[model samples]
Each structure stands twice: as C-alpha cells, then as structure tokens.
Target: MNGVELVCPAGSLPALRAAVDNGADAVYLGFRDGTNARNFPGLNFDQRGAREGIRYAHERGAKVLLALNTYPQPQTWSRWTRAVDQAAELGVDALILADAGLMRYAARTHPGLRLHLSVQGSATSAEAIAFYREQFGIQRVVLPRVLSAQQVRRVVAQTDVEVEVFAFGSLCVMVEGRCYLSSYVTGESPNTCGACSPARAVQWSEGAAGREVRLNGVLIDVFGAHEPAGYPVLCKGRFRVEGRLGYAMEEPTSLSVLDILPELLEMGVSAIKVEGRQRSPAYVAQVTRVLRQALDACHADPAGFAPREEWVAALQRVAEGHTHTLGALERQWQ
Candidate 1:
C-alpha cells in the first residue's frame, strides 16, 4: 500500500458519517433500490441522501464510493444505466460496478468517473483484472474473500489497477457472484436482487423446541434454549451430515485481518475494506474506530506492527458467532 486507505461501509447517512469521522479513507454505500448489494429494508440512500452523504464525506477529507454493483436484467437495463448517470450527477467519488455491460456503459458514458470493480465480479486473477482495466479502465478491483496474502501479492504485481481486500466483517465461503444457495431457498440472490437472504421471506416463531427460523418456508435453523440463532442464510445454517447436526456448510464467523495488516500493507494492497453495509451505524462506528487505530499504529511503526489483544477482542465481541478468522487469507491446513 502506497498509503494505507481504510474503506468502510455506509448503509446510511449516519453510517457514512461514522466512518469518515473515525478516519476512514473512504466509505462505500449503495442507493435505496436494487442498484447495490445491501438492498435490505431501512438501508441505503436516495438521491438526496447520497448527495448529503457525499458532501459530508468530502468535507471531512474522505471519499464516498457509490456501489451500483448488481447485474442489470434485460428488463431493467435502463434502470441500471440511469443509476450510473445519477451517481455521476450526484458527484459520488467513484462508482463500484460489477456487470461488464454496466462497466462498459460507465466507461463510455461517464469516462471520467472513477470505477471500482466490485468483489461480486470475482476478479481474483491478474488476467481477469487486466481485461477489466483494458476494457473499462477500472481504477480498482475489490477482491473476493478467497485469496491468500501471497495470492494478493501476485495479483498486485501483475496488474496496474489498484486492489482492495476485505479486512473485517462477514466471511462468505463462496465467491459472491456464484453463490446461489440463498436463491435456491428464497428465489433471491445478492448478485442480482441485492440481498443474500431477503428479509421479506424470513419467518421466525417460538416453538416447543425453543425457536425456529425459516426462509421462504424452508427450514434454515432450529435453536435450542442454549443455542444462539444465527442469521437465516442457508449457507450458515445448521444441517445434518452423516446423521450429525452441525454447521455442514460454513460456521458463523467474521474475517479480521488485524493479525496480518503489516503483511497486507507490505504486499502493496491499495486499500483495506470493512464488510458490513447492512449493520447498524454503531457497528460501523465501532469497527471504523478500531481499524483506524490499528492502521495509524501500523503507519506510526510499521516494523513494530502487531495486532493488539484488545483490538482482536473488540472486533470479536461483534463478530458473527462472536469469533473471527483471517478467512482464506491464511489457510491453516495448508
């Protein structure tokens, strides 16, 4: 990293301010419609809200990146294109897009606007990144949470475009663009519908078994009196494998790269991004403050950069399942 940039999530105006005020280099957010991935109820910004958020970020010397990251269906092509125009008109610092068609539209129509390839695009290879940089002149690419630190170094060494990786937040087991387990259960996918497990389809009730949660009438999880109920996403749900009920797919855990911040910066990662856009402003504020302190500490003493126990504990407190990992950034089995 030439300069350490901490990119935070902002699902709302207050979240945006929280990030900027806490020393975030940039805050990424989406509109109130299907244009962004975190399109849940009571989240995202309208035009007026986007403008206000952008102003607040700029005034604080931070950047506001607009996420128009969902794919545009044939029936909704104009809607996606119009969103690109709106982001430009609203003066967002950059446009984070995924679909090649949308990226082309942004490149040709709003050539001057900075474009970041969303992690949904899954450009983990240097060749994939090169194609985007050559075709649309994308300034940066947000890598999916599937690459190790050495892998990140390889991609950075080969590509001219900037690279951003998730530093803290929810850990997904698959490349975001390809995950369809949720769609199989809920008929909605975050890549297109802007929600992994859309809130509208979730059903919860107290039963003699303690509690049960379902998505689109599909049983996702059943919790006993002592078991904590995780989110209703199918991938993170408990399942029966070999007659043993457990996390057959993936566990409820968060990704925290605090242990490897020095390695990431040393590898020349252009930015570190936090991954909670659907969380509360308080979540945004807390995570931002922690990452800011850690990043500053790294700069103040690069050779002495070691993750503080308190930082790990603070992030773990809000982590999914109250646990954290380096994700695929470091595979212990390897």
Candidate 2:
C-alpha cells in the first residue's frame, strides 16, 4: 500500500521545526487567537511566527496548513476574515476552515489559496462533503473521528475531495466540534471560543485520601489515591452509567492507528493527522518520527509493517490513559 501523507501537529514555532525535522510531510497549526481549534496558553503561533513557520516548513519541502477552523459569532466575522487573509498573505499551503461564510470569503478574496474543510462542520456524509466542495472549493477535508475505515472508503468513493483522518492523540468521545460540556459549566464554548474546558476553569481540591477534579466549581470527578488525574475536562471522566460509576462516554485514552496504516491507505485516505496540539514539542517530535517511519515502511510492504510495542510505549508517555485505541478507525463505537 502507498501510505498516506503524514500530517502532524505544531503548536509552536519550535514544535513546527521539530515535526518537520523529525519527518513530517505536513504540519498543521493555528494562530494564538480563537481562529484555530487548539487555542491553549503559551501555545500556537502569532502572526509573525506563522509567517516564519510557513517559510521554515516550505523550505524543507513540507507543507504548512493554517487552521482557521473555529466558528464565528455574527459580530466576530471580522476576526475570522482577517485570519483567512493573513494565512493567504503568508502563503500557507491550505486553510482548514469550518464556517461556510468564512470558506466563501477565502475562496473569493484569496482565490489562489487552497481550502480544507475542518471537522468542526461535521461533514460526515458524502452529500455534506460535496456541498462544501461545490460551494466553497474545498479541495481537502479533515474527516471527523467518527468513521470506520469501511465507512471512510464509502465516503471517499463518493466524494472528489482528499480525505485527512486522525491517526494519533486525544480521543474526543463527544461529537467533534459539537461538544457543549464546557459552555454548560464555564460559559466558554469550544466551537465559538476555540477552547474546551478552558484551563483557567480547571481546579483540583485535595482531600484526605484523594483529590476532587472540578470544572468551574462543579465536581465532575474524584480521583482516588491510586487513580491519576488529568486536566479535568467535563468529558473524558469516570461517570455513572446505569448506577455503575465508570467511564461513560469514553475512558481517558489516545487514538493510535499505527497498526492500521495499510487499511487506511487501501481505503484511499489522502493524509493521516495526529491530534495533540496541547502537548509538548517532545511528544510531537516522537509521535511524528514513529508514524513517519511506519509510513515509509508501509510504502514498501503494506502487510509487513506492524507497529512495534516500543512505539506504543513511546506514545503512552503522553497518551491520556497510558493506553491507546483504534477508536472509530476500527469501528469500535456505537
């Protein structure tokens, strides 16, 4: 199988360089503002940084995808439009967008700029994808992490656009870009604010035997002495289901598709995406390197490349539960 392009994450200029140097075919990133999805403190590029990053990645024959993927308020159209303009001015390889108006603006204003449909729009069906392709000229699409490889193959056979699927990093059990757990508690929406469970709202209260993980003062989870606590998002927690208190939506885990590279390639995907932009540069470099190596191997012998246990060990250092799953890629969902 011809393995798909390796599209990795770059939360900072240094991370961008690391991803490229470590063997990424393309790196996806965002500006510091709400224009991108992974808006976190001390992460993301400023305007100047993005320009330099584009140059840095392009010089190495790797592409840079600028994520303008957030939905805009009626009054905040200006911010979104300006970001699109800036990405075009900086000569980014593509703009990953969600809003229809923003996509139209990009196509009309920056005609030469390439358009990619972000998963925020929830373009799951072939019909939905075609709508964007016909209307806004989106050449590529970041498919939501909700399709089986078989379902993905069906979508690809039906649409004319290039498909990008997430291969590694945080698994969002809630619907992609449509979660409201943060807003219900903190008044900040991921879709509009480009943040989910904002960092400032997270708090940990120590108890005699353990700690309570709270979000905006609401107790979402309680960690026992033996249990470890993460950043305390509303989702990805142990909750009650039918009187049993355990992980309901999903457990804290990362999605790993290293073993399924050949299947994804056989299904005709265009690129593989790694999802952790909130993570460190070291995490980015290591994951990119392993996937790049796997991809290189798969191009030679499709069935011969099985991801080593060491690669999984390397990934588990940053994986949410110290475990990984094939997730929707293997149809492991309802």
Candidate 3:
C-alpha cells in the first residue's frame, strides 16, 4: 500500500474547484449535455466551465478527468465525438470513456490523450479490461463496483492497465449500473438521460395516516405516519420477496469504505473513486477533505489508521439513508 489517489466527483464549476481545493488528486465530471453521465438539471460543465475547471485543478496540483461515459445514439454520434475532441484539446488528464467508436476516434485523433475505461461499460473481469487496453490504448480502467478486495487483487494481477474502484457514495445495486428498472417505470433512461426517476414522473398522494408515492402512474411505495419516506424509485420499493415485504434491489445505503482503504491500496488499486456528481458543492468539498485526511493518516501508518468517526458520521447526515454498506468491497454485500 504505497499511495492511492483520491478521485472525486465535480458536477459544476464550483464543485470542481471545491474538490481540488479540498485535496482531490483527480476530479471527474461530465458535460452539461447528455454526453456525460450526470446530465441532470443544474449540473455538469459547459465548454467554458470545463476549460476553467481544468485550469483550476491543474493549478492546485490536481488532475481533471473528463467523463464521456454515456453511449451515443446513432444520430447523436457527432455530439459525442465533438465532446471527446474538446476534452482532449482542453488538456484533461484523462478521458473516462465507454463508447468503443469514440475511444477509437480519440486514440487516432489525439494520440497523446490518456483514455480510461468507464464502469458504464460493465467491464468487471480482467479479460474485458485487457480488451479495451489492447484495442484503444486505455491506460486505466474504472472497474465496476461489483468486485471484492480479493477480486480486485486478482484483477490487478491479471491486467496491465491501472485499476480504479469506487470506494464510497451511492451504492448502485443494479449490476454495475446497467439499470433499466427506472426507465421501464418512468420512461426516462438514466444511461442516456442521466435521470433515473424523472422529476415529472413522481407524485405524492396522501393516504391513510401515510402517503402513497407513485412513479409513472404506478405505486412505488407507501410510507406510514412514523416511517420516513424516501425518494420513491421502483427498485427501492418494499416488495413481496419470499412472502415478506422488504427491500428487493437493496435498502437505500451509501457505500462507505473508509475502514477498508487499506485493503484496496494493498490490492494495488491505482485510485479510489468517490461517486456522486449529482451532489452539492458543499458535499463534494467535505467528502474530499475528510477522505484526504483519512488517507493521509492511513499512509503514514496502515495499522495506526483509525477512521475519523465524526467525519463518517457527518457523511451520514448528508446521506440518503441511515444505512451504509461496503458495496462490493465484501462479496457478500453484493
């Protein structure tokens, strides 16, 4: 466990600056359009924003990785292509890409640009990583958050490309984010639209001593008077599984790996990515700063590493729920 880079998320220009200011080794963001993953309202960088963000990060001794992670539609190839060209021209440290055609184009057009395989491609195994590396000259691969620390070590041993794993943030339980559950119910594709349950699809109806949460005309969840209601996505619904109503996809839990950083670093992971580009700038700043401090302490003495419980607790305050799981860090958590 020599040193592990902190790869954070930046949804907007202010968030980008916050991430760098708080000690993110690298920050990944998407464009304002659907070309990037977090293509929601009031998020992502425009062309001017991206240029300034790159400049800001570089000045602060941090790198900016542009995320062109979404797959392009047949008629939308030109939009995605131009984004790749602009990201390279703006001198992003690397381009996190998923589209094969765009990767090939970048490899040819901008020969010096560094390419990283995105988890959206669902490349969990070493063979898939190798295929991208061999074909498009990918230098790093953000492995899907579906492998345990031991499995990460196996991947590291098998691939020449540097491995990056998500260590914290939203625990997306839908098979490395190959999720169509929400789109099926809400008619908005998260993969292309960057919105899971589109704001327009959700409705709250008062029920008997509770509320009925609906999505796209379907009943998602019913919250009792004492029960705290959450964002009613279909997957998080309490369904009848094995004759009992309980969470099926997963109970809403943020992934926390502050205590398992040593295992990831020992597994030879090049970087630990913190997911949540949709979060606020304050969220970005606090998480980056605390994680950096924790990583610093761990690097100083691995055995002496004691996670800052207050910081971890602060995270829960901003978290979507009270639950936190080491998503994929332990295989059973999957």
TM-score of each: 0.97, 0.96, 0.95
Question: Candidate 2 lDDT, tens digit per residue, 1-334?
Answer: 1458899899998899989999999999999998888888899999889888988999999999988888888898898998888888888888999888888899999888899999887888899999998988899998888888788889999988999998899987766777788889998877878899898888888977588888888877888888777777778766777899987777888898887888888778899999878888898999998888888878778878787777778888878888888888676464
Residue-by-residue lDDT tens digits, candidate 3, 244-329? 87887788778888878877777788998999898899999988988898888888888878788897887777766876788777
The regions of model 3 sitting more than 4 angstroms off are none
Q: Rate the local accuracy (lDDT) of all candidates.
A: 0.90, 0.86, 0.84
Let me know the TM-score candidate 2 reaches against the reference structure: 0.96
lDDT of 1 by residue, 1-334 (tens): 3488999999999999999998899999999998888888999999899899999999988998999888889998999999999999998889999999999999999889999999999899999999999999999999998888789899999988999999999988888787887788888888778889888899999888778999999878899999878788778988888999988877888989998898888888899999999998899999999999999999788899988888888899889889988878886612
Best by lDDT: 1
As for TM-score, the candidate ahead, 1 or 3, is 1
Give residue 155's error in model 2 in angstroms.
0.7
Clashing residue pairs found in predicted model 2: none
| Model 2 CA deviation exceeding 4 Å by range | 1-3
Top model number, TM-score: 1
